[model samples]
Target chain A: MIGAIATAIIQATLVSAVYALIAIGFTMIFGVAGVLNLAHGALLMAGAYVYGIVVMRNIVPSMTYHPAVGVIAGIVVVAILSLLLYELLVRWVEDNVVITFLSTVILAVASTEFLVWIFGGQNIRISLIEGQFALANARVAYYEAIGFAVSWIAIALLWFYVTQTDDGRSILATSMSERGAQLTGVNIRMVRAKTWIIAGALAGLGGMFLGFDSGLSPLMWLNPLAVAFIAVVVGGIGSIKGSVAGAYLIGFIEQITVELIGNGFRGMPTLILLVGFLLFMPQGLFGREFAHE
Target chain B: MPVLQLEDVDVSYGKTQALRNVSLEVEEGEIVGVIGPNGAGKTTMLDSIAGYKEYSGSITYDGTEVSETSSGKLVNDGLVYCTEDRDLFPYFTVHENLQMGAQFRSDDGAVQESFDFVYDLFPRLDERRDQEAQTMSGGEQQMLALGRALMSDPDVLMLDEPTLGLAPVIIDDISEALERLQDEGLTILLVEQNSTFALRHAERLYLLEQGSIELSGTADELRDDDYIRDAYVGVT
Candidate 1:
């Protein structure tokens, strides 16, 4: 029992790293831009499919390339896509909460249709690093460990940029107070644009890992979107740190439930955790002062 | 030309008109004061000038029309507003708050000098440089707000109620700082509830009531007015 618990904890930590990436992007996008971004999962799907198409060379026939090149292409394309979504769509309707919310859901549905048209509804496998290792007496994939490392590195770089650089700090300050940001000459529009770009890169990296862990499907975005939404809410709606903490908490809950109970109950516990947070601690751990003027 | 000018400026909130055809001007190197009753539109006037609220009619600053300019660009171009809300980033330390005031400036030496200038003006901020803004006392937050505005190195500093609620001692410190700022030829547009403070600091004063100017004159000219004494100054 003890060994099983330890193994579960170890696995949970790896799973939480990717969740952190997805939720952090989701929360920051909400905090800064005031957009719920229901299409965040679609961005994730784009990353996986884009990475697969480039790395596998099945679609383009003559485009076989290094996996690293594929990763870069996936991230860049998603970043550009995120920027365009902001400039072309979200910017125009963000002020109307109902319109923006419905529009994002529409975008997500549209992306699914697009993906199904191209890749079909079948789950397609992508080749990844081929190795396994032992952790807490349980066999763990090398891919999971690498994904974990990349997630943390990206998070660390994001943290340093936010705290140590003026341009990056503007995003945080704007999320804190929009009027204050304007008073201090921080360009709110530019800060919001950069936030969407960051969200895209993070979602791409995290979504690519999710596809590698399972298999790529047109609808792979649904579960991860639900996970990101629950994590964001449980961690507090507009906080970046809270989302990270919430992600880990949800990840651990799901992992431990699956470990102790069964595979059929993987996500059942997080639903309960989400409801409990919403009821008792709606602000979560880091939701204090998350509002802006 | 006046450094700042507003002509026939009008503002409305849905159905109610807040300011009706208001006109004002402040020449360079002048401390202009706007004082009014609780419901009077003093802050609204400042808000309109700061681009926080939209208004009709012409507002010119340094030979350019500013009605179309954003609040951020207005601050970047030297029309800085220290809002009544003291909109400091609550989680940021005192030093970080001050750095934000000067973040856009290109001169390192000037920025460093601003840091020194702020610390010298509010030594409380110097002592608590690492303290977060939200944790500080209201008076200290007010001082930090003023200090942050000063960091912008404003050509025209529009301050709204710098001494709203404070101990007399802190107000004295702010008074001394404002006097020194005036001595160094800084233009200030001060909105204050404290009539005495406004009278002492402002060279020219406007008494606003019911969304329009009731009286306007130099400080000496308005000092003996019976209405000014009865309504605002509370002096015999």
Candidate 2:
């Protein structure tokens, strides 16, 4: 029983990090573009499926050379996909928030259904770094630990990019007051397009890691997207720090719940927490600045 | 040579005509004042020239046709319109806001020089470089807005309403700054409700009434007119 509890805690921590990456990118697009992209989940699925195909089929040729190539290919595939989507679909209806959101929902549902049709609704496993690590009295998978570490590094890098660079500063300005930014020569449209691409790429990375951790499935992205939305809402709409903090909190809660109760009731506690958060602290654990709007 | 010219420009918003056949010009090193009562198309005229509002006629700047040019390209070509509302990104520090002005400008030394120039123009902004812009007072935000335009190194600076919501002392300070820029041989297009302020600072003036130019003359000529005095000064 003690061993099972320990394993649940570790699994929860690993899963939380993956969710953090998705929430971070989603919150970023909301911050920069001021729209709720329901297609975000589909983008995540697409990334995972794309990466899965590349790694499984050795499409990149050099991916067989190293594990790092798999990561790079994953980023490139999602970026290209994101760019095309933005140019073709998202751009035309950008200013109309309602239309864009509906389009995103349509896109998410269609893409998910299409993938299930193609991949046959069965799980396809990926073995990027398949090994176990023993720490103290507990044995855990190396990929889980690696996923957590990669998430932290990615979040850190993203935070740095948003705060330290000129482009990042402009993006922040765009998030706050797009018209103001444009008056000062910010390429508002291009900035948003670039943001979508980056968000998609980050989602790709999260999906890639998730695929390696727990096999690729057409529907694997939905659960993570739900958790990501929870974290983003609990953290605050557009706040970076809030997203990270909320993710860790949610991750630990799930882990503890599974240990104390069971897997069947693991989701109930999160739902209750989310409801409580929305009722009392609707601004989020931080503030509206962190919330995705 | 006339550096900026708007010839028989007609502008509309949906169905309502905002500016009707409004024509104006500002020569190099000229401070051109535009005065009018409310809804006299003062802002509409400037917006038309700035490419924010579409106009039917031609807007030529520095001998180049600019009726169809985008605002970004026009800004890069050294025509900047400082918006009236004094909008600033609330989340950014004063320095960051200033840096955004130089987004298209790549020169480090020149950017630094412009930064220093703005600081010199408004020492209060330099004092609060790291502070968020939203925390500043209305006058300071106006100064920052003007400072932002200066960073673009624009050839013709069009100020919509620089003195709005500022204290009388700050308004004086802003007027002094505009005069200094004028002394530096910069062209300006001034739009203001306060005729006293405009007449004092500008070399030439246009009086706009209900979307049309009612009067055009040298500043001294407009300053002495009885009708102008009765309309603007509230003197019978």
Best by DockQ: 1
TM-score of 1: 0.96
**What is the per-residue lDDT of model 2 for residues A127-226, given as tens digits with 9 covering 90 to 100?**
6677898764477788778888998898888778877777777777788777677677778777888788778888888888888877778777677777
State which candidate has the highest TM-score: 1
Q: Candidate 1, B185: how far from true, in Å?
A: 2.1
> Can you write out model 1's per-residue Cα lDDT over A1-293, one digit (the tens) per residue?
77777789888999999999999989999988788999999998899888899888565678778889888988999998999999999999999999999999999999989888987889988756788998778778988998899999999999998887888888988888888888999998999999999999999999898888987898899888989999998888878788888899988988988877998999888888888888898877787645754
Give one digit per residue, the lDDT tens place, for model 2 in B24-130: 99998899999999799998888778777778888888887776677777888888889888667776789988888888888889999999889998899999999
Q: DockQ of every model listed? A: 0.75, 0.56
Q: lDDT of each model, Cα atoms only?
A: 0.89, 0.82
User: What docking tier does model 2 reach?
Assistant: medium
Residue-wise lDDT of candidate 1 within B119-207, one digit each (tens)?
99889999999999999998899999999999999999999999888888989988999998998899999998888999999999998
Most accurate candidate by lDDT: 1
